[model samples]
Target: MSYFHKLIEIGKENAFVYEYMAVMDSENRKYYLERALELSRNTKIRPKDYKRCSYIAFQSFAWREYDIALEYANFAYDAKPTNDIINLLGCIYHHNEDYDKALSLFHEVNANYEGLNPYVLCNISSCYKKKNSNKMAIRYLEKALDVDKNNKLVYYSIGLIHAATGNKKLAIENFEKSLEIDNNYEEARNALNSIKE
Candidate 1:
């Protein structure tokens, strides 16, 4: 038996062990995830164990179990609420289509966290775009550019916003920039083609 399997059988109450194993045993993710949750409930899990919960939450997010993801994220928040964890919670909210909650949490991260994380800025831009506030979205994306100009996705997002707003020249320019950075960027290429056609 693998060490992870042994841990599952014997240390079934150790959230930390299961969390570690979950990552290690990627091929059997759902199995380990189930064992991890099972183990988590069986012990007096420490506050530090919340990191384990957060790991599980992230895995759940990757698996697209949004509700479980949020639930585990909240569990982690209850243990130790940091900017990173709160940012994760914000992303979960965004995926759930609770834009208001997502934006609020993102703003919370922005205010509380020391430095600007450009991904968070891009998320803010996404929220604004979802609200059809293209100008506001553009503002945030531009801010993201000031922070990290090399993010191809940022350029692609700007291209999309420009396209939506009928700024064809700017849209094409941003699209070309995005494709320049990533030759295999199919979405940017498709967008550029559609615009040209």
Candidate 2:
């Protein structure tokens, strides 16, 4: 088979592994990730050639291996600076508590993409919240809501910002809205319970 054909096979294998990972079976996920790495290595595939580095970084992130996650995320970013990879890199930085880097990447993606993406907006809000910029966080959260009002995560994040700002009523309202959208959202339920009002 040609190199492209081998790459395709590797991609299929990685997809299968990812699907298992989503089901919360860590052992099988690890198995597939390792296998994917092996196949890529045998084919002399560069880390950036086929999103292999990103998948590796995501697995590291899943395992809470922040350092490894950062390394792989960098490789992925270097390979193809797509919005998705940028977002992943931002998330890794956020996990490492490097709020500045996370915020910078999030803004970069948000600025380049003309259409509004609720996830990007919410992630930027999260980075601001981590930096204790409640006002900015709320602003972005509102923007996310404007883009997608039914986004349960945005409502939950808005509730968090309100709670942090001591706006109990608004917090409750947003949390309730989140629960209305996703009845099984434990974070929204917990936030609602935590609020005295």
Candidate 3:
């Protein structure tokens, strides 16, 4: 950590140093991330370091720091709008309750990508679910299953929609399928238990 701080002191414009410091310092992570983002933007180091921004965006999203995630994701998208970056930005939008925008971006990925991507399909399903379009949600999840029949999350997601729509039988069956695929899936196990109760 001190090494990183020393590097920063010597080369204050080094966005990578600030990003590294962000990874090393949990307590001051947001501050370090912000500084890295600021410097990276001003220094126009994006061509060489956009992936670092993408990584930070994902980390921020995982930590539920949606604003930080959005900032980094937008920057990364502007620098290089790869499919993964677009999907990450869509996820951020979904979490922020901007379901329409998220859906648009997810569909864009689905249409442009060559092969089937179950995760992207699941994300689309989630946006539909949020919009109270359970039927559409189920449709997308079914597509996900078509791509990967044994995908635990797809089964679990189907179970959730069924459970929400008061179709306990289908919900239980899907949850069971999820557990069959991955018995260690705690979410499926808990959902099954709750359904039974």
Q: Write the per-residue lDDT of candidate 1 for residues 36-68, one digit (tens) a residue.
A: 666555666558868778878888898876876
Model 3 C-alpha lDDT per residue in residues 1-197, reported as the tens digit of each score: 78787777787547678778777888998898888777766765455557888888888888777888898888788778889989998999998899999999999999877439999999999999999999999999999999999999999999999999999999999999999999999999999999999
Q: Which pairs clash (backbone N, Cα, C closer than 3 Å) in model 2?
A: none
Q: Which regions in candidate 3 have their CA more than 4 angstroms from the true location? A: none
TM-score of each: 0.79, 0.75, 0.92
lDDT of each: 0.82, 0.77, 0.89
| Candidate 3, residue 160: how far the Cα is off, in Å | 0.8
RMSD of 3: 1.7
Ranking by TM-score: 3, 1, 2
Each prediction's RMSD to truth: 3.1, 6.4, 1.7
Which candidate should be chosen as best, given TM-score against the real structure? 3
Which model is ahead, 1 or 2, in terms of lDDT? 1
Model 2 over residues 32-138: C-alpha lDDT tens digits? 45554455444433544536677767777878767656765766676777788888889988988999999999999999775399999989999999889898998
RMSD of 2: 6.4
